[model samples]
Target: MSEFVSQLSDSLYAVFQSETFVLLNTVDQESGGPTSSAISWVYAVDHSTLRLALDHRSRLVDNIKANPRVTVTVFGQDTIYAINGSATVTQDPLAEVPFKMCCFDVHIDAVRNALFYGAQLVAAPEYAKIYDKRAADKLDSQVFAAMKKA
Candidate 1:
């Protein structure tokens, strides 16, 4: 069995300092099932804390409100990690962004290595925004700036 660490390692913290491909998992309030969402506006506030932003109208808001426990799956440092944590809404509508954005604070509980034995990751996941480049860049810049602040 893989060992579970209590917080993000230094390498993971550095990886999360910038926007990256990640999966946010939450519990379904209706069916009591696990729900997952792909997210990029995730920032590591510290080794044990993270800050994330999403649209205020995103269903993830309701999911977190219903159940604070969440897991953020990230692929970095040649492996996959499940960052287990509890989350809470810190901001309803972020003032810096032109659009309404919701911010959440996640306090990490344990980080588990999710990769199977003998499997090696060749490359980290990458994504591209399909929208207007200028608009997307501006939005990401604003959102990340807000997330980085204490």
Candidate 2:
């Protein structure tokens, strides 16, 4: 991958790991056009593979099935990264669980970082709350225990 593509992938991974959402665009094969769709729910990311949770019936899915070409856009505080790649839909029962778990872990890590850095401005309120609660609960039960005891 080129530096720009690598940066875009890293930025996307960061955003997905935090927000669990992204703006996904796919190219229409027959018409050779682009269709933009908001995929706010992603299943996970393992290395370079980005697994998104989308309806099998949706146009975006259809578009992807027809043509694996896709572009994913992730927004940060001051920077936006666009990733161009190919996506393949998988229905493998055995791989499903692990893929979802990986995605969840990435999200958890993102939540922790966002809370730690006070970068909740770019996240949805409910998402921030969920992550904040997780962080608070973890700290309360572990690192912050000494302070509470003191």
Off-target runs (Cα >4 Å) in candidate 1 are none
Give the clash count for model 2: 1
Candidate 2 ranges with C-alpha deviation above 4 Å = 1-3, 7-12, 92-150
Candidate 1 worst ten-residue window by lDDT: 141-150
Q: What are the clash counts of all predictions, listed in order?
A: 0, 1
lDDT of 1: 0.88
lDDT of model 2 at position 103: 15
Compared with the true structure, what per-residue lDDT tens digits does model 1 show for residues 1-150? 889989988999999877797999999878889999999999898899989998867888888889999999999888899999999888877668888888999999999989999887788888899999999899889889877652
Instruction: Report how far off residue 26 is in candidate 2 (Å).
Output: 0.6
Task: Looking at model 2, report the run of 10 residues with the lowest lDDT sum.
Answer: 101-110
lDDT of the candidates, in the order given:
0.88, 0.48
Task: Indicate the TM-score of model 2.
Answer: 0.53
Q: TM per model?
A: 0.95, 0.53
